[model samples]
Target: MKKKSTHLRALEGKSKSEKKKIRKEFEEVKERLEKAQAKYVQKPKRQKATTSKAENKKWEQKRKDRYNQRVWKGWRDKDMEEYPVKTYNIKDIEKDT
Candidate 1:
């Protein structure tokens, strides 16, 4: 990796080998994301439905949304694994006021 700029977040104070491993894992995730995204070449067009059909579709949509939330959580968990962090103290944060 190139010498990091001051603006970037430093690794979790781990050894260079461990940091490299994390970086490799993240790169793999990025590649997998790119490959998965390639399957969707264009935006999905929504279909218009009648009143009752729309009502039933709404419940099905809620179900799909709940399933997608788990996928979102999986992505978040992978990110935190690579950049495992410690909580900051209030004093450490710069005040905006």
Candidate 2:
């Protein structure tokens, strides 16, 4: 059999009234710990509703306006330029090669 700890031996030597007081304090601490844990437990958050057709259209228009503003700003800052499209004939290039 395992030997009892010194603390256990000391506790065993205490009077009944002292033991009862210690037991009551232990119960109170246990109850308090349970209450604290319950208080901190996370609740599920409510989800947002899906956007309606009108809301989606509004968002799309806002996006287009934002893009146009950015393009205009770039043109004003001389950061935007227009280039002419160049077309190539594959047969003509092959004949040259």
- Local accuracy of candidate 1 as per-residue lDDT tens digits, 20-96: 88788778998999999998878788987656977899999999999877766776688864334458778768663
Model 2 lDDT tens row, 30-58: 89999999999999999887998899999
Highest-TM-score candidate:
2
Task: List TM-score per model, in order.
Answer: 0.33, 0.36
Candidate 1: pairs in clash: none
True-vs-predicted CA distance for residue 74, candidate 1, Å: 82
The parts of candidate 2 lying over 4 Å away from their true place are 2-10, 44-97
Clashes of each: 0, 0
